[model samples]
Target: MARGKEQPARRGGGGRAIGRVIPWAVIGLWVAAVAVLAPFAAGLDKVKSDKVVDYLPSGAESTTVAALEEKLPGGGVNDFVVVYYRAAGITADDRTTAERHLAVLDRKYPGPPTDSAPPSIPAGENGPHTVGADGDKTTGSSSRVQDSRDGKALLFAHSVGTASGEPSAYLPALRKLLEDRPAGLEAKVTGPGAIEGDIDAVFDGIDAKLMITTVIVVTVLLILIYRSPVLWLLPLLAVGCAALISMAAVHLLAKNFGVVVNEQSAAVLVILVFGVGTDYALLIVARYREVLQTEADTNRAMSVALRSAGPAIIASAGTVAAGLLCLLAADLNSTSGLGPVGAVGVACALIAMLTLFPALLLVLGRWVFWPKVPKVLPAGVTGAVAGQARWDRLGAWIDRRKGLAAFGSVVFLGAVALGLLGGPGSLRSQDQFVKTPESVSGFTLVTRHFPHIGGQPITVIAPTAKKDAVLEAAEAVKGVSQVVPGRSGAEYAEITVFPKDAPDSPAERRTLKALRAAVDKVEPAAAVGGPSAQNLDTATTSARDEKIVIPLVLVVITLILGALLRAVAAPVVLILTVVVSFAAAIGASTLVFEHIFGFKGIDPGLPLLGFLFLVALGVDYNIFLMHRAREESLLHGTRRGILGSLSATGGVITSAGVVLAATFAVLATLPLVPMAELGFLVAFGVLLDTLLVRSILVPAVGLRLGSRLWWPSALGRHTDPEDADGQASVPIGRERALRN
Candidate 1:
């Protein structure tokens, strides 16, 4: 302990002021802030929108079409198909039961007019209408019911005015009605409308579900790590405050600034705040405990820990926030919105951990550590010297076998990266759910029975004057099975075009392109959009976002690392390793998704999101290591400094990594496949980085580079006795681990 420098900190000068007065004031201020902000935080879900158009790329044709649809009569309508199936055949009794259900539906919700574009027709109160018929001649001018040629399925199309309500509100009631049927007969309501409803159902209460799961996961992990009854609560409480502040900030941004907040972004915000906030808490507490081993006064010890660990925490948060903000450049609204949403979360977490968290610990003092309370050690002893023998030996072994360790790690990561060869294509909407919902089952039945025109209808908006020409042009397109004219506004008319293949199919994608080309030639102002078109645009925009946002994130991280380390080569090496780590993680995840989980493909936006998280977060461990090494190097030169820093930071960094990875893994508990895929990849990547890259590869590489790792800095050019062979003079195993 340096009495000369820390004497005032131990006395009643600044130390007493911080210990006695500031902590209560900080805690008081946080209490008031939470009271004022809690309602806004709770109101976050009110502003969250998962609408397709809300997340579509700005200026895309689909977005334009969506805007135009809102201006038309009935504000556009929800289209769906009701499929009835029987394995053997539709017997007389089965047909009778289907007719009864249809009649009930028709009477409850009457269609427009027989002449107008009515949604569907149910069997009537009129004379016994023929049941197993094909086409529009089923006793009503408003509806069309088609029986499959194989006599196994009956399919019907319907539309509901969006002005009436969202599909999410009404589809469940309709499905419930269909639930009561004869044995061996199956009924499913599915199409664009039902699919939308199913997706909505998944996100309905996601905020609450995600928050509860993440908090429980973090709480359990913290309790296990601390092994103290009381110590874990302070960090959990601080994280709760951070989450409240973050939700309020995001809600305000969405309400006032029009920043898009979707279910996915909101859910991710909760996980990120809890995970990253706890990580900062772990690092701060570890340093505080170490300082407490030598300093008698808790406040003074915390002051020292803050001074030592604060810069690394701030650098890490800044790097993550910067990388996330790079998504602002993306064309996809969802991707761009996530950038700020996640940044706000990181900022709130940083502030809460640095402020309220430290204040809570200081106010509670040494008693909080309980049974294993930190007692002051002898004058020269520190916590690291008394513990962490394994870390010391591991650092020494890596230091000695630098060449072999670095080469082996690179080879291992490269081999894992080879899993990318088994390509998983972009995910379809039908495949979005981990469990097959009723809508997906119905869609499959529809496709099986109606092969020619089974896909969701693509809506095209064209000038009313050119509607006829546009319809004719669309019908000429190769994949167009049918083109029906929908309602007409004063200037524009809607046209529904059905493709022969299923939605999200390659054939359907081709059909969309051809339809767009044909309609554009007839009416230059026309735009093509629907559920299928939205999917296509979303995939296209996500790919474009990857190209722009990913490189920007890399550049931002590199700059931050360069400034933090005050070196060129070290930052570059860290960036390269994180990038390779991301690749390997994604590749490994792809294999799992394909073979184990039976996922058809990954979400289009996943690549950008995963890369941003892994690269920024993977470098976080390296920043802690290299930052400490930089301080140590100024005294002992690079070789000994890195070895000492590795041993010093190894346990705390690994714990932080596990805490972060576990928090992200909570997302896998959700039903959405995208969330699960993202959760698994990030969790796996963080473990790989913590267990392999940070523990061995980075330290090994640093040793081989020696002083040159800090090139252009004075630390790099300095020569010490240990610089002769770029090895530590005394083996780390024989000495006490370096003091904090």
Candidate 2:
């Protein structure tokens, strides 16, 4: 580096004053913003809903039933089935104990008991029917106690009005009523309502847990990456600021615009902001350090860093936000709600990192990098160190054996993809939790003692005039064991059908379809809905959403890359690598779920969510690499530029990737199966993209294309030696000239 190449250590009086004042001004603005928004952020949880109806597809029959249920005289109902059992078989004493528990429930949780409440078994049926606490037929009451033929279990089925609130609010007290059961009888509450209660309980303190854990994980990793106890705080602080802004923004959207924010989306929002905000910090810091080696003025160094690295950072954020926003197209409420929530988070992160983060860095100055603070170097001396030598050599080798590198990378990704041999299986509600709750245990017990009767009811709402035809059609379904008439409303009537198979069983699904078809023919206005039907609709709707959203996300990202890189070929190559990496990640995750974690099956929506994350976040590293490569290629030839860019960015990009992966891996701490599975897949996919896809395959492809990699761009053609001559003395890594 020559002296002429160095930027002046001091600037004009006006420039210096403005530069000094700008940082403080930016800091003040952020403080005010945080002070104003913190309250709303704290209120974010108030708007979140985790109800089953909230997550189901908007137009699904189950969703419609849930909406219509609210319109019935006593429509909003929570149904519970309490199971009492003794392995030795229910003795006469056990029956008495069960009846006492039923009496307690009836007295404590008794609803107004409208026609819309779940019906009791008809008299003289083959199976056991519910009897009142005094052993008489319980008519027009919400509680019913039935015994199993095996003489080992007793089931007390009941309904309560949902007017109080979600089942979670009152179910705990109801379950507590059963805690004093006789020692010989094992009592547990299980049913659709109880299962939902358990789920809500799992997410009770999830945000706090995820926030504390994520902050700790990111803090530790940042400390290690920066190697300075004090230095790591800056990025973390900036990310916290971003988190507050995002939380507030999301809360407003959810409160005012009817955006769906569930526990899962809220949890994920935290991880995304932290992971992505920290990533932007890493890239900016690396560029700032690079600029500081030549420009002594902190302001000038920051300006140069932002000018050079800011486009990639913006593009990275845009790509991720755009990809997430594509989720708006999903039919599932939870899935669609996540789109804007995540996009807002990413946008907030971008705003904070690009604005507040840089200002904080400038205010702190070189001390921010204290232990190994970058120093100004002589004009002809570069910042390249021995650690970067490996990347230069690797780049040269990749260039020399481009074909082999590409082939090996493809083969490796494909091999990992072999885990998809057995398709990602469908997850059942019972398996949705990593640890079994009492609801699951109770459901299992009920199924064991009453295998012939479905433990869950399939609800059918039909026009009052066609109730008889719908009932006959529902009973005609192959897997249906009984069709019980339910309360009649002004326009519609309820018909409860019991399937012979379990709710999650294949036979139940078949029966659901057949029942829907049969009823549709008899009464077009009739809708088949219930816990089982909800599961079926969610799976099918999620599959449909994947087809629509994934392709849109791909196009959105490619266009972002094309505009940022200003090149077609490079963007296409990067997109391809990201897509392949996504597939491999999904494949590997499927195997891990089935074998390592022992998850029963994958969530139907996991693939779409995983694809969005892997592609958007995975392409982030390539944007940093290729953007730098494009800048360098204009000066040096494409071969040397690619090598130099690789050497320069390889360290920072890998660090960013590790940070992201670690943040997402935090998701595994959650008890929900879907969150854990998603966290693992994204984490694994990120590492794959950084370590192999970006590091080797992408660079190799770029090197093979040479200057032509920037098709349609001026840099794609011959570079003007005179233009290159102005910076011929621009210092680069000594090994960057490695033979190709």
Candidate 3:
């Protein structure tokens, strides 16, 4: 087959050099990057930060409240009704006890607001009131709480806003006050903050849990790959610097540009830098190990490593960064900003892989593999079969059954592909985390007590040219079940339309259609907003975003891949493969959610995110594969070149896939269903990339391409043993050592 030693492969040079020298330099740069926004990350959310209170739930969804709702009061629960109590239970003495208790608890005022100005209280009177013209009162909180039916049970009622807003700051103090109560009557606080506080308490060790897991996984993987503690420190140093720089960059952008970044996302960013960066580091370090095994000259080996693996790493980085850019398509600002932060971080990791990592490798010299001397391969380095004694048998087998290998690979991928029949989750059954705390708790309570609980409310925002009276007029519109006053005085009222089902339910669609007709009947002037309106906005935004962002990301990725590979067809083919892989990933995610997780379909935005992530990272694997294939092609001609490249590159990509997929799979542990489903989908996608796309399809395609695979090139005709194209063909540094 003239397929002698699979193409002359390039070995390690840059990974070790950069591993040794650049981390120190990167330290300075990272600190400077941190200084770029140390003021911000340190204090971006310091002043009444919404991020601080946002996810905290009020007592409504607290476990205790849920337990109680399951017990008494006939049936329904008032989401998180704070029972205000002033009762003269059976006698004046009992009543005074109740009043004294309420005063001690300071239960009358509905808490203070951040502005120090009181929040406009809900229009309803606090429960039922007993009043005479003389302004007499024996009522309110007592009726709701203390005067239990048949006088056997007495409970008081009060009200509080959601924990996510200004109300949350002081909600804790209020709860503490209630807990410190007198005997006979228990002051039980149940609100949104209470629920969140409970979750926090229940999952107190979550951060520690995640950290321990990550460290254990990473340590094991690093030990396996680098085989040295020294090598471990190198990747950490590079990635730590990248993380600091990325965070600083994010803080700076948010501060200067007013781009809102949710605090919850900060955690996601930290994990991403470590996880993805580690994978990239593995690729570079492994290449260095390969290079060190061959050439005696440390510098030359390092250069060869860089020249050969550098393009692949750079290409991978570019693809990952560009894919993250696709996240900008998310209509929600909080989710959208995640894309760029990740993209920028990945970009930094790539640059460090090439520059700083190479510098460190140069400094470390042989010490990088300290504790174990570098293995020297003296057999003219016969591509895949030379020093990889580990996988000789497997390589030989693939060498023996090329057709069966290709067919089995394609068929296996197709089986996974069929899983794509299911679509991503539907908004109707969005994972539970998105439910309004009140809706969730109240639904539970009412379902237990009342045989019939009404459906979800479709909130209507009454828009106005003039702020004052528009809301009043809006409340009077037909088909509206109830009018809840909005924060804006009369300009924007929150009209609740209770449909037969929730907003995403088909029954709600009928309500929406009726509501639209009702709005149409209103004077031509008054503007309105409802779930239908929001849905329309979402659909339009989604469509427009797909049109613009998908193409933009694809174009950017193509350019970056082409530039890195120095080959047009390679990037184009890889991109196509990524696109197909992405579709299959999304399809698989949808099927999982619908069939296994019990969701109806995938999130509308899931495809875009999957496309962005898998495609971009998928490109990295592709580049890594082709670059290895191209290197092999140089020495082994076409046939052996393909075999050698596949064997050598397969292990690294597979390792990366396993590690990455495992890390993402941990997201399934999150209580939120979207995160769980997303985690599974991505984990599966990465697995598919490593097992099917990278190891199977990519090589099959490469083998089929033969010489045309590296076309329009000066090196195209130079693979004959007579022609010498040194990997470190041109020295790339200020000193001989740096030149490699």
Query: Candidate 1 versus the native: TM-score?
Result: 0.93
Worst 10 residues of 1 by lDDT: 731-740
In candidate 1, which residue pairs get closer than 3 Å at backbone N, Cα or C atoms, i.e. clash? none
lDDT of 1 by residue, 1-740 (tens): 24334555236566567568989999999999999999999999889887777779987898988888777776656777788999998776766666666676666544433333643233323334443222233533333555665678776777776655778888888888887888889989888788889989888877888888888888898898888999999999999999999999999999999999998889889989998899999989988988888788887788889998999999999999999999899998888889999999999999999999999998888999987899998876655533479889998888778899999999999999999888579998889999999889988887776665546788898999999999999999998877767767888887878787778889899999999998888888999998889889999999888988889999999999999888898999899988888889999999998999889988998899999999999999999999998877765667778888887888888989999999899887788899999999999999999999999989888888877788766555544566636433433232223222
lDDT of 3 at 492: 29
Error of 1 at 186 (Å): 1.5
The sequence of per-residue lDDT tens digits that candidate 2 reaches over residues 492-559 is 88778888787767888998999999999998888989888999999999999999999999899999
Ranking by lDDT: 2, 1, 3
Per-residue error (Å), model 2, residue 308: 0.5
What is the Å distance of residue 625 in model 1 from its true position? 1.2
Cα-based RMSD of candidate 3: 9.6
Minimal lDDT window, size 10, model 3: 115-124
Clashes of each: 0, 3, 62
Predicted structure 3: clash tally:
62
At residue 717, candidate 3 shows an lDDT of: 30
lDDT agreement with native, every candidate: 0.83, 0.84, 0.54
Which is the winner by TM-score between candidate 2 and candidate 3? Answer: 2
Best prediction by lDDT: 2
Q: Write the per-residue lDDT of candidate 3 for residues 418-493, one digit (tens) a residue.
A: 8776454255332345233432443343323221212433444344343235434445544443333322322322
